[model samples]
Target chain A: MATWLEGLIALVLIIGGVFLLIGSIGLVRLPDLYTRLHGPTKATTLGMAGLLLASSVVSSITQGSISVHEWLITLFLLITAPVSANMIAKTAMHHDLTPWKRTKGQELVDPASRQAPPSDHHSVKDGKLP
Target chain B: MLTWAVIIVAILICIALFLNLWRLVQGPSLQDRILALDTMYINSIALIILYGIHMGTGLYFEAALLIAMLGFVSTSALCKYLLRGDLIE
Candidate 1:
């Protein structure tokens, strides 16, 4: 019974690891900034959740109880990953970064694309960039 | 069985980590490097959690949580700086 459960946990871990690995590969290989942002934000978040799930299971089995803290991390990650991705995407836009040629036409869909508004220019005027 | 699985996953995650490092090093743009750093820290959390599972120790959980918190803060700060041209008004 113990070994069976361990095998199950291992299966979860393997899937999580593969997700994480693919996320990293995307981070390295994706053509442009905006497109690359999609990879780590989604896949890695799911991967982390899987690993945390495995941890929760292992704790329950070995320590004879469920651990709530891994779940906390899981929730924290789920909330923050998309938020971080949003911030990063906005920042990239503020920098006027371009998309890959293959993935062009973002300017048509996203009015907020590359061009900073007049108000954004005012902020830059008031603040000194490091 | 569990031990072998953990080792194999760890090895694969390490390869992932190195790929992240390569992106961090060779990334063409500042945004790309920042993204690389973000992904790397997240990978670290996965690695730590896997280690804790293998050892059956809850201690590493705290470390993973801390990394997650700090990583988010750092990424946000960088974004702020990039977006506003200044971190603080």
Candidate 2:
């Protein structure tokens, strides 16, 4: 007889694997960099979180002691994924990489605030704070 | 049943890892390759965790944590290098 604990762990693991697959598919299928950025950052992050949770469940059930350490991995990933995605996107924009026509890429660049776009930052810099 | 699920999930993640590998090798831009590498490491962590589960031990957690740290730092450095043409100013 399959235990409920085993069934739950299996379900979570399968779901996590599916999401990882979807994220990779998105990476390959998406045409533009900005759109492509969404693949690894969002879907893959969640997928990893799912897998970590499943691991925690399995460990706690079998060893009769909760493994709280795995949660640290999940927490670290959740915090970093979005930040890394943001930094990578900013770098892409600095390179003047074009976005898809359907994408309103300019909205990502706030005109009213922040320093000049990375491309112009060099030439526009007077070594003065404005 | 749990073992079967682990096998299936591992296979799926392996397929995903290969896809990320393809992108890393056939990248049209540096950013794509970096992103692919980042995703690849993340998938590997999943694989490691699955291995730990299969072994019925949490010992692999340390290795996964190290991979996570190294992957993030590398991705950030690569992206920074791309943006500024230097890793550190």
Error (Å) of candidate 2 at residue A91 is 0.7
What docking class should model 1 receive? Answer: medium
Task: Put down candidate 2 lDDT per residue, A1-130, tens digits, no spaces.
Answer: 2488789889999999999999999999998878998999999999999999999988887777777899999998998898889888887776767678787646555531244444445555664555
DockQ for each of the predicted structures, in order? 0.77, 0.87
Q: Considering every candidate listed, which one attains the maximal DockQ?
A: 2
iRMS per model in Å: 0.7, 0.6
Residue lDDT tens for model 1, A31-87: 898899988999999889988898898888778766688999999999999999988
Q: Mark the regions of model 2 whose C-alpha exceeds 4 Å error after superposition.
A: A107-130
Error of 1 at B58 (Å): 0.3
True contacts kept of each: 0.88, 0.88
Clashes of each: 0, 0
Task: Point out where model 1 deviates above 4 Å.
Answer: A108-130
